[model samples]
Target: MTSTSSTFIAGLEVGHFTDPRRPTGCTVVLARQGAVAGVDVRGAAPGTRETDLLAPTNLVERVHGIVLAGGSAWGLEAATGAVRWLEEQGVGMPVGPARLPIVPAAVLFDLLVGDSAIRPDAEAGYRACQAASPATPAEGNVGAGAGAVVGKIFGIARAMKGGIGCASVTVDGVTVAALVACNALGDVIDHDTALPIAGARTLDGLRLLDSRRALLAGEAPRPLIAGTNTTIGVICTDAVVTKIQATRLAQMGHDGLARSINPVHTMSDGDTLFALGTGAAGKAPGMMTLGAMAAEATARAVVRAVRAAHGIDVAGLKLPSLAELGRA
Candidate 1:
């Protein structure tokens, strides 16, 4: 299989189009030839498109692409641009002379972190698709992770900047890769050391605040006014699998989220995960082994998102990156 940095799956092309002006953007995962796919949405306030089509009982056996973007529900429009691009390439389910691309999408609430009036649109999505390639995807403060922030349990004032992250692992002959946009309502932690790496910060911006501890102490701040939060991502592999297995892979992917983020899948979060199989690898691993590997990759991706992030000042409000905070 053709290998891209952090992506070992063949027939998969990853790309992103970022707008630092709005400080938001979109990421596109294109499988022009189509690939088996599945989805799992665990958050109570998710914004997603065409997720039902990925059900094992659905008639569609494969999907053309997946879109992850910022702008909350408004970001969903980005999928249309991806669809249009795929259609132009003659990739999709044939209906007549034209083929309709099956593009599923999900979005995170980054409106509050950037120019709220400016959100990702169809044009942004099309551009992302046009940039698709089997190359190492750019991480941190790009694409859907551009305006992402985490640790909102104490409100946006205490939240830290979040971004995109990716990781991959090879088990037997199968390769599993995960890409994530970290925008959540809680803090991000390092699973290996069980230490808080990023999230809410003290008012002085000198130390990390334990969100869960604060909430338990009845000092939780009111929710932010602008929008809810979410963490959305995709997991791709070269193992052949049925839709049922793919769905299981997505569920396991959530285990990774749980490992890295505190207070995840909250009511204010729209966490969603999608899994795709290219069927390029010679054989598939057992369900248990595949799911376990997916979880590990997902966890690593979440940490990388914050670690790769750089601080930015938006609208006179300075949001610090994990690296900067570590220095302080």
Candidate 2:
């Protein structure tokens, strides 16, 4: 049987730990039974851990969990917590005498969104694991998306709130799903309508500014430092796949980003995607079919991210939601 909820993949659980003090936190996706995994990094500047092990030639074939976090590189500590929690649960790759949790993680730069000092840490990551569930994950201004913002082409003052979103598709009893934390450097568009949904605003802060067209028109943008933006996500499927195929799935997942996010994969962004194959359904769809489903799920998740976000007004930072802009 297939789940009606898009986020419910067969063999994965999702969790988030958002810092109450500031807009910084972490999210964890657990494959406790172990799943074949691969990763693809499209942006120029990415902060990640244990990604090399996901290479097709690497020794490890499966990962126990994947972490997506905020607080720049410091958020990588969250993965440490997830590792510890998994170890306590006796879930990990069997070492000579001990069980070592295999967790690969990625982080986005959210330091500028709130108090940089209040970033996700080992404890935050542990809490996120404790909150893991199979139900649909909470979206918008939560998890890694709490501190996320978009459309920085004009600067922070003209940016909109970015967030996390999830979607899934099932074909022939094989399920594929995606969960994304959207913190892009450009505008988010409604793929169906081809209109800007959230992103850079006019200097007057009254209307949406089409970032792609504006950039093409040679409008000078504010100086955007590297590592200031990113969009991180995970693609999961019940279909069996090899590490190489999983990597290709991650690569195709980027198509979803390109479809919904303008000016994606910029030098300042560290866009990364990870793919997990659980083999829960004991079904192996053709690679082409799986990739197409992945792309579609990813694109829908990206659009849902901005639409689900709420306006942010705290600590002297104010990023409006699509609703606030009358576009929701």
Candidate 3:
């Protein structure tokens, strides 16, 4: 599939603050007026914050920001910085004299890919907030995708680089977009062609090894693998939708992940998705249509993440990019 070239949604600003030193970073999606939001965590090992508040029964109807970061659980602190930034800007749920900024966040494990000691913190979140903008944000190796790696079925020794990607589509004047940081323990596949784009490489580094095929062949790796992978993302739409509908949208977003990644949502991966509805354009599409768009956009974004990624050497391990494989 071709890379997403012109995908955008109104009423949202995206930004990133990366620390290449640790090879970890944070990404913030801000809505100054707040947006109705919902989340769906499908992976068995998710690391998140404030997800309970996004439940349909929760009293909070809107959220000010969403944070995606590296550094495993420690990266949740980035959400605090995002909340502080929003509060300083006078945004959030108004109660008495204070506005409690609601920022839901998710983290991916990149510790083994880079400097495990340093992770994204409140300061990183704050910097991402300051860098927020409406223009298309840079993809691959920026923000939460900085240290992302994929296809660890055989272990880190055979893994390839992964990163952030985005895609959007306008249906009947309503825009739906998806931003994804691909850090899965699976191979990325081109949904349309059913071909592997990025994943574990053979020992010769001349061919892609399909993780699913290997697993199905009864090739089981060590048993100590835990919390070593995840893929996180956000789906944004200009359609007016309720919290339940938003939740449904987030659930549908996983269809994209399923289509593009082999062996997804594994026990060791924390795959989480968030949906945000701005309702700023005054025209809302049908729920089915919106959900389909969300899935397609998400799939495209996942492919883009692999396509835009650049190879990197972390510690003594070397990870290759799809481009380096002459597949881009």
Highest-TM-score candidate: 2
For candidate 1, the 10 contiguous residues with the lowest summed lDDT are 1-10
**lDDT, candidate 1, residue 44?**
89
Clashing pairs in 1: none
lDDT of each: 0.89, 0.91, 0.90
lDDT of 3 by residue, 19-62 (tens): 95867899999998999999999999999999998899988889
The sequence of per-residue lDDT tens digits that candidate 1 reaches over residues 61-132 is 899999999998999999999999999999999998779999999999988865788899999999999999
All candidates in order of lDDT, best leading: 2, 3, 1
Overlapping backbone residue pairs in candidate 3 total 0
lDDT of 2 by residue, 1-328 (tens): 3335745677789999999998988999999999999999999989999999999998999999999999999999999999999999999999998999999999999888867889899999999999999888898989998999999988998999999988888899898899999999999988778788899999878789999889999998899888899999999998999999999999999998999999899999999999999998898988899998898889888988898999988778788998898442
Off by over 4 Å in 3: 1-7, 222-224, 326-328
Q: Compute each candidate's TM-score over C-alphas.
A: 0.96, 0.97, 0.96
Quote the positional error of residue 300 for candidate 2 in Å: 0.6
Off by over 4 Å in 2: 1-7, 326-328
Instruction: Please report, as a residue range, the 10-residue window in candidate 3 with the lowest summed lDDT.
Output: 1-10
Model 1 segments more than 4 A misplaced: 1-8, 225-227, 326-328
